[model samples]
Target: MGIELAWTHGVYVLFVLGIILMMVLRRDTSLISIIGIAFLGLTATGSVIASVGGIFGSFIYAITELLPTILVICIIVAMSHVLTDTGVNETMIRPMTHLIRNATLAYWVIGIVMMVISWFFWPSPAVALIGAVMLPVAIRAGLPAIGVAVSMNLFGHGIALSGDYVIQGAPSLTAKAAGIPVNDVIAASIPLVIVMGVVTTVVAFWYLRKDMKNGMIAPASHNPVTSSVFSSAKVPLAPGIKRTLAALVPILFVLDVVAMFVFDLRGGEATALVGGTALLILIAATMLAHKQKGLEQVTTHLIQGFQFGFKVFGPVIPIAAFFYMGDSGFNTVLGEVLPQGSHGIVNDLGVALAHTIPLSKEVAALTLTAVGVITGLDGSGFSGITLAGSLAQLFATALGSGVATLTALGQIAAIWVGGGTLVPWALIPAAAICGVDPFELARRNLYPVVIGLLVTTIFAMFLL
Candidate 1:
């Protein structure tokens, strides 16, 4: 039986589609998202006053949820500014320039590094670490900044995050929900993740190279946070001092990695570790480089970093607010509006979708992918994965096979779509760091991810 639908669900889905339509047209979605939130509030509460307050409340919820990311980005950007100002950034990347001398090498090398690091610490930290260091090198090696963003996003968030082989967080969630062993989900996902990662990245790279050669891509502008905020007065660090700081930076980060492994830190703990380290580095670098003015310079760099962080995230907040309502933000924003027994708006929709589909290996594969995609629209790749696993179990019972394969397929699709690559707000870290429009990154990823999902789903059918 299908879950009962509420008016809130219909309204939510309508606005989601509208937001997507606006995005597809390359239009700003903030207005649409805000309007949607207001309407959802009004429809649920029947009061203009409450509805208006809900809009602001939803933004709070979004910001609260996104604060860690914002903090990390702001700190990392500040640290990066200091590194650049002190000439330490150039010294740091000088050795890497030899390894990534061309655009092709830059793309793959950075992507591979991102994927590996993400497997250990998750994509959020990996993005900060790699973007801070590799972005300049990649841009200098002739890869556009957006291209660098795409490579890191696809490899880290898309590939390593989806598989989550080392941490096993993604698989553990799906496995528990599917009533199967975590190893089964992991084992099943290895092939699907490989196929999706290889196909999507190859296609994206091909398109990127073709566009570059055709002169269709523009050279990237410098990050406004760094360029505009950095004073014309360069910090006169001795070459030896700059080299020492540069060397120290990597050693500090490497120790953080060792700590992650020893302490079993993951996700927010991992991000906090990285952010705290960046803060110390920012302070140290500023003090070392600025001498007499160091105290004041650190504050200036931090303010600049916060400005850029919020500026880049401004358009994203409203949309994220709207989507967050589809999950945990519902009660927080609108208060007991959804029908009783509802599994959140998005999950209910996924459940309804699964019930409506007929059972066959091909249909089951396709339905799981669709459910995964639908649930992923909430932008928390994880929020609806349990539903995906449950749906996978349901379909597998009906088809008498392929539970692990279907579960893996759903997990992969969910993470690829919402974990980052195709979601504008979800991918902000990469986009903001690389100084590209998040929507454009999402658009660029759309075809490749869609094609990959199609191919991987078909492959899942065969595995069944």
Candidate 2:
């Protein structure tokens, strides 16, 4: 039997095209997205008032859907800020610097440390922490500043955020959209993440070395953070406390990891565990740093944390809302004026393609990965993850592949691309901290990440 098509599907297709065009033109889709939501509402409800209402509804829905991720990142960033006050954050990387006596070693040392920290702290905090503490040493060791940014981005945002083994936010978002448990997404993504990470990082190092040998690298410049770190410390604390906290932080996180394995916490639960621990640590660190003023310090940090969190997630909410409706069920929450069996906006399109395209498993796998890459073009590695996740469910069912594997594949592609490697704006924090141009940083990371995504996508096909 042939499947029937609907006008809503066409609207969805046009909205997707609009979104893609906006991304391709490197334009912000916020306005376009708002317009699309209005039009979609008009078509569904056939009422101007309903259409206007849908705009607010979509944003609220997207924010509600994404609150967990936003909160976890905010709290983690706040916790890192608290650590910085005690100069304890620097201590975390001091030993790692000893291992990086040269630039060759600096590349891997900074990258490995970044990947580890990013898993717990999220890439935002990890980049800030690593950029402040490690960039100077890496440069001194002979690594270029662009090289440092690439290492930080590829490891922290690409590898760590993609797998998200520690925090599980990425996987959680992907899993939720796919209607699967977050643990399954996390477990399934491990191999894909490993493949992408190893391949990309190795390729990056090879390029870094070649650039140095050819003298293609620019002379390194020190940013203010680097100068500040080398300048002074008011408190004359012994190395023992720093060492203890460094040791303690990892142990506590490791325990959290173990508990995740043992207790089998899903994404939200695991996030709660990590966030709660981070908050407690933040409190303790503030108390130690400010003795009497700790209370005020903690409050100040919380406010700052929320501000940053809202800032990061603000743009994302609308984008995610426009896409979330691609999931059939969300149509109801956004105001169900569409006909029966809406199957979400994106899924409807996926189903249409499935019937018309005659896609092989390989093609389907690549297509999902391509869609993920396209979504990542929006420059928020996370904004399009839900769509990728929803599409994974659609494609897997249509192609007779495993949903978890395909979902992981899409997640990997979206993150590695938009997660900071390909996006100049996303690379700014690392690049700016390293005193490198963000565009140059993106250019440097482009080849390795692209090759890595291709390889990872193909590898994912076999699993599917």
Candidate 3:
């Protein structure tokens, strides 16, 4: 049987094209494009009443599906805020100063710390904690602001956020679209994340070396925070009890890894362990800061944490809602009213294209990866994952590749681009926080992240 493209599908295609054009020419948010497309889809498919129903339905569905993930994010971020306000974040980084006496060491240390913390709590919270404290130290150690930003982007956003092992946010989204276990996604993602991280980090280091040699960059000299706040505290003992805690943190995490291997705890179990640890740390930090004021301080930190979480994820909801409409499983919630046995809009499109294009397993993987990178040009990393995940399911069945592998590949590519590498606007926050030019940061990231992604994609094709 031959399939005909519906007017709704045409509206979706045009809406996507318009978004791409806007991204290329104007660098505007894709939200406007999504809204336009969604309304068009509803109008094309049904009467005015149905269209209205679809809008409300989509809102409810989007909120319901996203609430769990968003709440976890908010709580974790809130916990991070509590830790930071209590000076635990500072205490955590202070010992690492000894490990970072110079620019070269500072780059790696900051990158490593950001990656580890981000893996658990996430990049948004990790950035604030790392940038506020270690940035100045890194600058004084002769690392340029741009260097710090690059390190954070590569490790925190690019690597940790892409993997998302702890909270399982990224994997959950991909897994849902692929119709697989979230644990499977996380397990399969490990090798890919390591490959991309190693490749990208090495490239970033080379760039830093070149810039240093050319005298194009130098350490930052002035810091408002240092002169005003942190300078008053007595330098804590190095490699002391605090250092033991720092060292113990990773050791505990490694033990968790071993337990994961031995006991077979999946991503959620692992996240619970990590979140529990964070809460404990928050409690300890609060007590250490002030016994009587601990309650008030923790509350304050939680508030700041929620504020930051909302800031990061607020814009993502509407965008995710529109894309969720493309998935049949989610469409019911989004107010989609399709005939029985009909495939989703995105799935049907992929199927139609696959029939005409003659895709192999390898080609499907590469194509999805490329699509991910293309969608990422809009600079909201999470937005592209749903589409890529939907495509992964279609291509996986069509070409006989595993859905998890394809989904992971797409997730990595999309995040590396939209999260901060290719898109200048997305990197602006990190750039501005580090006091560097956003365009320059984006330019510096392009070669490394692109090369890394290409290599990782090829590796995924062969290995997976």
Candidate 4:
């Protein structure tokens, strides 16, 4: 060893460099990169034993910290499934179909529907329900499977879930990490989300318009009402009454939204109201399905809901863990055994860069946005957001920059990239549900998401 380098600064630089390389190369998941870094850090500290211990320690910490949140997500998804099996999902979409007579209108309508529902109940369940019902109609109306997937991914996952304005889930996480009020984060995120949404929607239309102009797309195979999934299964409600309820579903949802706004119920309260309404609809649908089978059917739906929830959230844990280590709040959860000298790698590196790098706030905002985009390559938007938020706080302090603006820029970038736009894995559910190719969806989303991120970033630099 040539006079072994200091573990403090050098280790941090190498760790960050590894993350950048992993993202640029688009290699395996971030979890793999984290493991590699952990080992490297261990070696730099001259202790293989310590590295092994740290890995296990980190794993344990992540599990404990995530359990409660994961359980909540599971319960919520389960409830949605119960609602779906009861035919409430169909009821919700039925009225919307009347307004969407053409492919162009269908795309925007579905996007809007997904966004609204997702803002309350979340995107996981919203995707399944929307895909199962509205997709076929959109397809028949002339929207391509790729188009539908893009709409759902952009609206539900990116726009709605990213801002999480109603439920405040995403904003709450970012707010907690930044030690700010959840309401403040929600209020701040609104303009940023709108800029991103408008840019993304416009770019998507531009790309889609090319396909439309070329006339290269084939119309979807049309199936008659009697041959459809709903037709095959006997619905619980009487035909006339069920149709009435189907009509009423949209009205109920609209009422929910109106009530939320009227009451000024911002976050968890809004989510609870939506969830409660969904539950009532679910019960009614179950009873209608066949009172005899309702109980068993509800159980089955819950199982499927849990399955889907785990599928979406499981891979996120380790990724979240690696980033969580960077935050002081979660540092102790990583285990108390680590030496006090083991500084947060992300903060330490950020501080080091702040001192050396000379840049205006505008430049720093852009840089932070780019960093968020780069970190998002791992394909978990929230993970990238968490990391970006932590880094933003560091950069804000060092440069005396606008913390909210930098944080919001990072929020926009991370969500645009990892929230199912550029990454194949992140787009998997929407693609699969829409019966489109995942890689193609990723490609379709590339230009629009990038342009949206750029526009929103520039807007943030000036507006905030």
Best by lDDT: 1
Please provide, for model 3 over 265-285, each residue's C-alpha lDDT reduced to its tens digit, 9 standing for 90 to 100: 543455455445555655655
Q: Estimate each model's TM-score.
A: 0.97, 0.66, 0.61, 0.63
Candidate 1 local lDDT, 65-133, one digit each (tens): 999999999898888888877788878888988888999999999999999999999999999888877
Off by over 4 Å in 1: 221-233
Give the C-alpha miss distance for residue 93 in model 1, angstroms: 1.1
Worst 10 residues of 2 by lDDT: 223-232
lDDT of model 2 at position 105: 82
Best by TM-score: 1
Q: For model 3, what is the alpha-carbon lDDT of residue 296?
A: 81
Error of 1 at 326 (Å): 0.7
Question: Which structure is stronger by lDDT: 1 or 4?
Answer: 1
TM-score of model 2 (CA atoms) = 0.66
lDDT of 4 by residue, 139-164 (tens): 65677777888899899888997788
Cα TM-score of candidate 3: 0.61
Candidate 4 deviant stretches above 4 angstroms: 1-94, 112-149, 152-196, 205-231, 234-237, 244-252, 262-269, 276-280, 312-333, 336-344, 360-362, 371-411, 414-447, 455-464
